[model samples]
Target: MRVGGTGHRLLHAETARMVERALHERLARLPADVLVGVSSLADGADQLFAEAILALGGSLEVVLPASRYREALPAECLGAYDRLLASATVVERLAYEDSTSEAHMEAGRMVVDRSDVLVAVWDGHPARGVGGTGDVVAYARKRGVPVEVVWPRGAAR
Candidate 1:
């Protein structure tokens, strides 16, 4: 199955675990032998979901918004991004040289276009910026993609 997701870049530890558990439960419903996870590998929810996919023996497909994605990520998240990138079965980088909001939106479109289902770890808040989690979820819905929102009760950013 082709699965993609979007969520916050920063998450509380409890929230992170909750998202992971939810991802685990969702992934459990699929056949273990041929699961694929598509994501940007962002610091919080995205990374957690990727890790869970890997843990469940699924293939990871990373979609980078721009060539300078590494530079855009916080220094602390660089290592995690690199690790996940190294393990990805596929890594597609957009043509943009810098990380811009437009680039991010295009990248999100790419993910949504390729996904059969989208898992959003949103908190029901308005999007803070272009290509934010809520915006991507909206995009997915607008495109008629099946979306599974996974914000556990009491989860916070």
Candidate 2:
């Protein structure tokens, strides 16, 4: 099973906990041997989904939006980002040199295109920017990719 993810980069502590648990539960349903998580590994939900997949003994396939993608992440998220990147079973780097919105959306499109299902941690809102969770969800829907939204009750960004 191939699952991709996209969501907010900033999440409240409690909301993150809820989202993480929800991601774990959803991904846990898949057989570990066949499970493969595809992600861009952004700070919040993307990292959460990857972690869940790793915890479940699933393989991770990373798709970096640009060559400078690591520099685009927040300082606090750097450590985990590096760790996850190192752990990826397969890593694909895009041709772009800068981590711009266009690169991000293209990366998200790549994930959707490679996925059997997209596990979105969106809060049922419009995207704040061009490549946000909502935009990814919309693209997934347009591409006819099955999307399982995993916004836990009482969760907020």
Q: State which candidate has the highest lDDT.
A: 2
For candidate 2, the 10 contiguous residues with the lowest summed lDDT are 1-10
Error (Å) of candidate 2 at residue 56 is 0.2
Q: What lDDT tens digits, residue by residue, belong to model 1 across residues 45-148?
A: 89988888898988999999999888988898888889999999999999999999989888888888989999888898978999998889999999999998
- Pairs of residues clashing in candidate 1: none
Candidate 1 regions exceeding 4 Å error are none
Against the unseen true structure, what C-alpha lDDT does each candidate score? 0.88, 0.93
Clashes of 1: 0
Residue 58 error for model 1, in Å? 0.8
lDDT of 2 by residue, 1-157 (tens): 8999888888999999999999988888899999999999999999999999999999999999999999989999999999999999999999999999999999999999999999999888999889888999999999999999999999976
Runs in model 2 with CA error above 4 Å? none
lDDT of 2 at 43: 95
Model 2 TM-score, 2 decimals = 0.98
